[model samples]
Target: MTVYWFMMAWVILFGILAQVSARKVCVGEYLGEEVYESRVHLFVAVVTFAVIVFFAGARSYVADTTAYIKMFNDYPLFQNAHDVIFDSSAREPGFRLFSILIKTYISDNYTVWLSIIAVISGICVMVPLYKYSCNFGVSAFLFMASCQFTWMFNGMRQFLVAAIIFSCTGLILKNKTLLYIIIVCILSTIHKSAFILIPMYFVAQGEPWNKRTLLFIGCIVLAMLFTSKFTNLLTDVVEQTDYATSVEEFRNTDDGTSIIRILVESIPIILAFIYRNRIKGKLTPIVKLSINMSLIASGLYVISKIASSGILLGRLPIYFSMYNLILLPWLLRNIFDKKEKDLVYYIMIICYFFFFYYQMEIAWGGLEYASKILNVKY
Candidate 1:
């Protein structure tokens, strides 16, 4: 709790400084409307990136950190590498190769390996936020308060790939479909779940609430209404994948995503709906895509709550939920008129603060970070 508390505070401080020190730039043209961009301060990026990467990298314990460390410790680096990476039963060749290279050339200290991964994951996420986020401070707050930062602490393999694709968001706005798919395919080697982003790329295109977006919403409805059938079909699909054995461990056993999270993640889209007409004419490419992505994320959360197999479906939302970091601040700034703005911001701050407390202490039972370099302990 000590380290996570410090990390969140540090990021929020620098996140505010990032906005204070920002410069505006044009990213690209969208339908002849100039796509405005905010260039996040490099110094702030360095500070934020350093704290996040360090705390995450230096961890010796977390939900899955020990498991990851043990796996890295046991990897067959350069010793029968083929058998290890190319075994039919094997997967995530990219992560395996990435780890092997680090062990072969860099220090074998698992901490150093974790640090390097933290560097990659942190940079991938930071660069995109640096480029795309209209309000760095607000985005940073959401990034932490919403518990998206847990990905770095818990699921490095998939989050690494997700971060990589997230940095390529400019490609989506540029309408580079083939290139985006190619990039996703390459990243999928690291985590097969990266394949999920392929369809999402198309869904993110065009205006908000388009037919594709409505169809995605319809699927969520269908998933909720026919949970057992959805789970059965999902189970059949999982049984065919590498996760077949994992499915046997538990089927629709874990409790669903909490209602609090659904409400928190739903805030941006809720505001968007309220101000739909007000913001329609002002929609930019990045904001539109973010709106759509936020909707997808909220819909996934709904499915995760109602569907039989909530745990499996819940993880899928992170791929889209990240965009809420971008969309939420924009809504707060643009959707509300000036008179109602300060009140909205106050409500937001109060809500997220309590939510963060609940999530950190009550839900996770408090986070503990241990690091020899920093002489920190749980």
Candidate 2:
């Protein structure tokens, strides 16, 4: 707990420091308005990246990290690496193949593997924040404070795949749908859940509060109203996809998503809807896509809570949730007038920090960190 708490504090403090030293993100103005164009302070961002990647890579256990460590060790040595990677029954060959190459060429130790993976995942996530976020510092804070950083610590396969897909934020904003879909197709081999993002490419397009946005809301409402029916349909789809028996495993274990998390995810989209008309006229393509993705993430979280299977539906939102880190900071900067902006900023900081503590100390209270290299465990 202390390690995580310290890591979170260090990242947020540096992130805010980076915000203090801004650079010109664009020449004149953003969104056709003469607003703060200077952003993405590089020095502090690199610092934040280092601290985060270090802790993530050094971890001995955090939700599925120990499992991944075992998996990495059990992977056969380089002699049969090709067969293992190319095996027809391989669920996600890309990651397996990647692990083999690292083991074959680099050190075979899992520490080396975890460190390398941590670096890759960190870069994938941070690059997008550097490019799209209005307040890179705030977005960095949001990433940790919102507990999205857990993706780096656990769920390595899916989150790593998601991080790679997130790095292609440019394609989504540039309307390079075909190329983006192609990328998703390739990454789906790393984690099949990535295949879900294929249809989301279309869903993420267009203006905020569009008919598609309404449709997402409608889908959530229907899923909530007819949870049993939705579960059966979802289960059939899962079966056909041929993933493990996650459906049955979690079918009756519906503790549901935390209401606190749902509110945290919901706030940004709610704010967007309130300021929809004001923001619509000024939104950059990236911001628009961020809002749309935020909408999807929030909706999924809500449905996960209302529906019968929290784990099943909850897993789906990671595809879109990173965009909330982008969306939230942008909303804070642009949506309010000058006087309200400061208040909103403080309120955001307080709420997010509280949520961070709640998640780490209570919800995920058993989270422990151990590392031989660091010579510390807590």
Candidate 3:
């Protein structure tokens, strides 16, 4: 717990410094100054990246971290890549191959492998953020505050896949269909959930709060209300995939989606709706995509709430929830009125801070059980 708090403190401190620096650059650009990238901007981004990698790479405390370590230890290094790739196991093939390669060549240091994964995932996440966010600090702060950063310590392959998919946002915005499809195909090999983005690309291009959006949200609501029936109807289809067994297991669990999580996810969507006009012109494609993805995630949360099979479906939202980190910051920066902008910014920061606290201390407890390095004893 102490370690978690300490880490959180650093995240907050560094995030503030980065936000301040980013705000200056934004202001300079607004004033028609030819502001190239600033030292402070580069420094903060590097520091934030390093901090996340350090924690994510070093920690062995999260539940999934242990499973990942055990899987790496148990995997046979000499296994044929083709066989592993085509294996019917529940594990993602790309991750399996990753583990096999590490075991085959790297020292049997699971920590090193974990760290490498963390660095790759972190870079994939941060690069888009640095390039696209209206204010880098707010985006970074929201990244931590929304619990997206902490989630990186767990859900290793899913986050990795999501990060990779997220890196293609520029392509999606630029309407580069062929290249985007190619990238999505590569990333889907890492996690099947990534395939959802193929359709989502089109869905995100639609106007926000329009008839199409309303219809999409309505369908999700209906699905959530009849989750059991929906799951039953989809069971046969689900059984045909690699996730069949896991889906079966989750279907039997009684847990539902977190209400607090639903609320947290909804805040940005609500804000986007309220400030739609202000944000419509700036970062147009990216904002539209973000709003669309966020709505999809919220709809998933609703479905998670009413389904006995909610736990499995719940994982689908993170792919979209991450966009809020970008969307919210952009909204804060683009507010029409200066005083209102500052007010909204501070309010957003405070709300995100509390959300982060709740996530670490309440919703997901025992966050301090992490280690700074590998524990050889297992």
TM-score of each: 0.93, 0.94, 0.86
Tens-digit per-residue lDDT, 272-370, candidate 2? 999887777678778888889999988888877776545666777888989988888888777889899999999888988889888888888757778
TM-score, candidate 2, is 0.94
Q: What is the lDDT of candidate 1?
A: 0.81
- Model 3, TM vs. native: 0.86
Colliding residue pairs in candidate 1: 1-367
What's model 1's TM-score? Answer: 0.93
Q: Cα lDDT of all candidates, in order?
A: 0.81, 0.82, 0.73
Candidate 3 clashing pairs, residues 3+ apart or interchain: 1-368
Query: RMSD of candidate 1 to the true fold?
Result: 2.4
**Candidate 3: lDDT over CA atoms?**
0.73
- Cα error, residue 276 of model 2, in Å, equals 1.2
**Positional deviation of residue 14's Cα in model 1 after best superposition, in angstroms:** 1.1
